[model samples]
Target: MANFNDSNVLSSTFYLTGIPGYEAAHCWISIPFCLLYLIGIVGNSTILHIIRTDSSLHEPMYYFLAMLSLTDMGMSLSTLPTVLRIFWFDANEMTFDACVTQMFFIHSLSLMESAVLLAMAFDRYVAICNPLRYATILTSRRIIHIGLVLLCRSTVLLPPLLIHLLWYPFCDSHKLSHSFCLQQDMIRLACADTTFNRMYGLALVIFLWGVDSLGIIMSYIFILRAMLSIASREERLKALNTCASHICAVLILYVPMIGLSMIHRFAKHSPPLVHILMANIYLLVPPVLNPIIYSVKTKQIRRRILQLLAPQRCFSTFK
Candidate 1:
């Protein structure tokens, strides 16, 4: 076991791992992964295109949806090159800088996604709880400001996380558990004490994800309270329906995220396949599912998609 005193750690080559015992099935595994990438990329790209072209989706809600789509696409593309390299071509070697760069983008985009979801929850809150002031509360300028703030928040805090890891000397076993780099996986290879890194990472997760999750929950609580105050049951139902897509989007992201975190923290002795599958699901499921969810639930988006697919039928059905 190499320790902190290892002088060659900075130049060490890190290799990504595929499924532990299924080396021969790597090609088969790539098939599902490839399909997922295809669906995620095309699905998110289509959402972005529709949102851009359709005038009806120019509201604050769809604007936030567009941000979600872009973040999903970024997450997908961030993992694509290395994932495919490992599973398809058996090429998994990465230089120190390359691994750090991938780690930065993956984690940053994830934080951005959390922030976007939080913003979307607020949008729903305003639209449902204060319908009259929705426009004023979430103006275009304010939305842009929120976007800028999210961008900065997601990107700014990541450098210290990655920079700290750079100073730690790695052990002889520079093998990463997943197809892509993660700070958790990277720190495990460090020869020095990683207590600080682990604690700092936990602090980040608590601060970023924990706070965003609480904000989302609080928004929904207010939304529910305002919803119940409606005199008519039908009105309450109608209001609840508007949030279904966002609720689904939230679950799609945070569920797998929590699962992966648990596996990393608690399930140390579990099968390697568990970690790989959970990690992939955490990254891929939301990007693929969010677009489908919104397209199905948002009548405007659905109508636009139907129009693109079958114009006459779309008019007849919607009319």
Candidate 2:
């Protein structure tokens, strides 16, 4: 760690030898990941544009969808370049402030995305269960308000949480097991007793993510009940179908969080390369796959994506 008295500084200059073995294998994996990231960026950007330009899609559903895309971009911005550096250039060292910034953004966006998913679930429930009030409840003003609340909530919560992390003292072992300085990885480096850190983290997880997930499940329960009550079997089936993509998305994020936490606890001493691989996968999997799942599940979005990618007809009846 850096020797500064006041600022808790890890050293600025650091060494990062390339991946231990199978360097070529890492490169092969990274090449495909880079392509996936490119697709994610382009695809999400197109969705944002279509959502903005098409007045029909300006409701709360696509609004939350756009926010989800934005949060994914933020998550990618925080994780991907550092991961690429680790994979391609062997440039893994990060300054103390850089590492803290990375951690804060990654966590902040993650929390915000969770809140956005919550909003989406509420939207779905209302649409399926109470179509009449959906327009009034999910109006433009209400969505804007919800967006602000989500942004402010994550911003306020994450900074104080980060300050606590930053000031917690670290031991001399500056080497983080993961490709990026995740919360637990950085805490492992702490010189002070980190029981407090673990407890606080668990509390946050239970309160924020855990409770929100429960709420999503409840929303789905109510939605299913309402779907069953509908007179038309086709309407009931359609309502059920609309929820499939969100269920997949929720699984992608929360299931990985479980794997990541487990790996941090039981497998920290595992191979350094495996640690790095899981870290990158945890960050990349949800964002890269989310827009794809939603697009495939939602026909309107799929059509828009296809039309945007289609080559324009050159000489079709110019008159």
Candidate 3:
């Protein structure tokens, strides 16, 4: 075990682990991961392109959805290189600074996703609960301000906590149990007392994930309440339908996150494959599914995609 007082800690390289008991299957496993990475990247890029080209998607709801797509792309890119390297070439080594950098982006982008989801929920609430004021409430300027605030909130609060990792002296067993770095998994490698790390991590989780989740739930509750006041069944259904994609997005984002947290904190003695599977699902599922869900559920986006795929057909139909 190394200590904080030691100089060697600054120069150490940490080893990353893949599916622990299935080293022989790494190449095979990389296949599915590669597919997911491609889908997430291309899908998110397509969403961004469509949003930018279509002037009709200039509203607050679509703008927030665009932010969500961007964050998902960011999260996938942050982990993709290291994950592929570990699976493809058996290269699992990362320097201290690199690990810290990965951890910061991975976790911060995750928090940003949560914040964006909350913003989307707010957009829905305004559209449903106060339809008359939706435009006034979520102006383009306000939306831009919200995005900047979310960006600042996610990027700013993390570094002060993560900077402490550099000060800790690590143990000889610097193996992190994933293809990429996580503050939780990496902090355990430190030989010094990680009481502060553990506590601060807990606070961070509660503050970010906990608060964002609660806000989303509250927004939905208000949405449901507003829907109930609408006497017509079809109108109520239509309103609820608008929220379905966002509801699916929220579920996909949070369910795996909760499972990963449970496995990390409570299932310490569980199989390594279980942890690895949950972690990968946590990282991979949302990026791949979010775009698909939105494209299917949101008619405007779906129509835009078709127009992009078959522009002559779109032009002929318009004629």
Candidate 4:
């Protein structure tokens, strides 16, 4: 008899036990998801490496991009593995402890990403609206302090939140309807009353991510209006173009996020299978698209990416 505590035994046990019901044909879905996950890792890693190695990108905007890439990496890691398992292994059976861990990370990283967006918006506002004092206002020390503060604040949410999840009683059908463990899906599995989880989750989303996104939107509106009043066409174009990448990023990040919240809240009656797909989109799409948005819209990143990858191609030196 193999002891469950034995490392190799446990690995073999949970791996093949796959999701409870939908194990068949999960392979088809796993292939595409695996591809997307690979892209997310490579893209985000490139941004992090380039930002760190290239001294030229050591400004406030790229500093925010570094944080964004870090959060994107965190966000993808939190949800993607479970999703891949669900797709390939039929592994819908998450123990209560594992479920809570997943929820904590997914929520924490989601919050961190939102905070990074707000910081990016502030950076853009300073760069476009007040170019002269940009360095003075957003010094390296200041940026690092803000990053630490954001990390600390977002992290503090987890201990209390996970404790809240543990308060719930588990149902017999511990299988999560969603491919991944979501706060909503976990709450739905509660045998005891789950009134608190729903209310608490909604409240946090509203006050935290909701407020941050609202502020970002307002910042851009003011920026655009201010751009209109500028005298020189060159200056105006420069200001707007600088913000172009930031705006695209905000839209791609927030739109699906808000949609996911709405779907969880309002579309409660949808089939679990449908909700599973939605959750995948919510978690996966942003990271997959974010690097593309930055690479395409941000001139500096585009040039750096080209330079960084240029060595891989075979360019001939003519005699």
Candidate 5:
């Protein structure tokens, strides 16, 4: 064990924990993880393909959805190697730089997803609340600009946290709580003061997620108000229905995120399994479910998916 007192103890290797106390069941745990990865990759890829192939989906809403899928796929790919290594080959050791890189991609992609969701909420709000100005407000150039802004935001905000981390000398217990590197998990292994890291991380979360969440809520408030002004109940319901998929996607991402945050903040003494499970859910569930939710809730995407899946039947019916 490297001495915690020694400030010069810069550990080069970090061990990723699979499922604590379930070393014997690592193989079994990997089964579900593999399935989740498969579903996430295929589902998000299908959503992207559908959006690309259909000209009708060339609008701002589908463009944002495509961005969301790309973010999900990036997050999944970031963790896939380490996760499989730990579970399949029992290889848990990660080099310091490699771990930091993985942490960067995972968290950055997460922030990107949050931004995409916020943009989707704004898209719906404009469509329902200010239909006349929707096209002008969310032009293709503006959407592209939004995408670039989101990418820059996600990429730029994380390096300070990581660069500070690179200087911290890790203690003997360099074992990360999850199969992938997390800034929160990585900080706990440091021998030096992680106060800056923790505080800055919290601030980033609050700034990005908190502000995004507030924006989403405000958008929905306006949307509901707009819906109420419509004289026809059917029109109101129709307008509200358009938001269902985005709402589900938001919940899928935020609920697990909030749960994981609570677990890390307040339930530090919780079982390792609890932390691991919550982390997995936080990372994996959104990617797998978002595509399904959109396919089921959005008629255009659903019909496109169905037509893709059953071309002959769709063709026959159309004929």
Candidate 6:
């Protein structure tokens, strides 16, 4: 409740917490967190490498999967350093500028992931509903354009908001509940009336993530309609099966996202561990699991990964 527009406040730094009230367990917690980071980085990187080398995977769906993998890699890399620092080394201090940068990357990557998932859903719809024209619809040039648009859309919207944040006066404790910086967490510490910040945050969520989710749901509706028209049940299942990995990816991303949002909004009274756990799940689960899901559900990716692991066993057929 003190005045924070003074010079001292301008230079103030925040200290991030690692599972509040569990300092003794921070080291223990770091093990699983580090493992998740390793899986996410290696798994997504392997996906990109396989996609790049496998000419057979040079299609729209795989192209979108590659984009998703790239986004997953970005998300993991963006958060890994701060997360490990907090849990492993107890280095929780973050300067304001650095915090803003981290927040921008985390939020921007999340929006980009939402856009990529929507794009993937559209790819599935085109592949299933109109296979004959799928190639024409999502050509390589068009896919590149879509990726650029998604990236640009996220890249452009956040800088102005972040700039606004950099100037806000902080009147509250500079301690954040999680290992990573987040716009919502940081803004709540501002002494200034953050009506605009709160509203813009809500609008951004609704316009970007909300619309992307709606687009995905609509695409699935059309896909379902197209599948139902097929007379053969097995054929319908096969067509739908193609989207299984994507469906799982969407669930993994959005389910935790929704849970995190709800926890921030309505569960302030709940135990700090609940919020910390949800935040970790949101930051860690998607990147770690997305590649695994795709490799398991998609036959081509699975076979290619297997071939990569055991080349001699597959050389007879793959070669």
Report residue 292 deviation for candidate 5 (angstroms). Answer: 0.5
lDDT of 3 by residue, 1-319 (tens): 3444454654378899988877899999899999999999999999999999889899999899999999999999999999999889999999988989999999999999999999999999999999999999999999999999999988888887798877777755878888999998988777778888888888988998888999999999999999999999999999999999999999999999999988888999998889988999999999999999999999999888888899899878766
Alpha carbon deviation, residue 161, candidate 5 (Å): 0.8
- TM-score of candidate 1 versus the correct structure, residues matched by position: 0.95
Q: Could you tell me which 10 consecutive residues in candidate 5 have the lowest summed lDDT? A: 1-10
lDDT of 4: 0.75
Q: What would the TM-scores of all predictions be?
A: 0.95, 0.89, 0.96, 0.87, 0.96, 0.96
Which is superior by TM-score, 4 or 5?
5
lDDT of 1 by residue, 272-302 (tens): 8999999989998998899989989988888
**Which stretches of model 1 miss by more than 4 angstroms?**
1-11, 315-319
Query: For model 2, what is the alpha-carbon lDDT of residue 102?
Result: 83
Instruction: Report the poorest 10 consecutive residues by lDDT, candidate 4.
Output: 8-17
| lDDT of each residue in 1-319, candidate 4, tens digit only | 1432343222221121233355676787678888998899899998888888889888888989989988988888887777777676655566656766777888888888888989889888887777789889999999999999889878886676568765554533455566556677655655567777677777877888877888898888878878988999998988888887777777777777777767777988876665556667778877888887888888777777887667445233211
Compute the lDDT of residue 162 as modeled in candidate 3. Answer: 90
* Candidate 2 segments whose C-alpha is farther than 4 A from its true place: 1-20, 24-26, 266-274, 311-319
Q: Could you tell me the lDDT of residue 209 within candidate 1?
A: 94
Q: Which stretches of candidate 3 lie above 4 Å from their native place?
A: 1-11, 317-319
lDDT of 6 by residue, 103-218 (tens): 98899999999999999999999999899998898999999999999999988988767778767777567888888899888888887788878888899899999899999999
C-alpha-based local distance difference test score of model 2: 0.78
Cα lDDT tens digits, model 5, 1-319, are 3454354444778898998888999899899999999999999999999999999999999999999999999888998999999888999999888988999999999999999999999999999988999999999999999999999998898899999986788755777889999998888878778999999999999999998999999999999999999999999889989998899999999999999999888999988999999999999999889988888888889888889999999888767
- Indicate the TM-score of model 5: 0.96
Error of 5 at 82 (Å): 0.8
Q: Rate the local accuracy (lDDT) of all candidates.
A: 0.91, 0.78, 0.91, 0.75, 0.91, 0.89
Clash statistics: count for each candidate = 0, 1, 0, 6, 0, 0
Candidate 3, residue 15: Cα displacement in angstroms equals 0.4
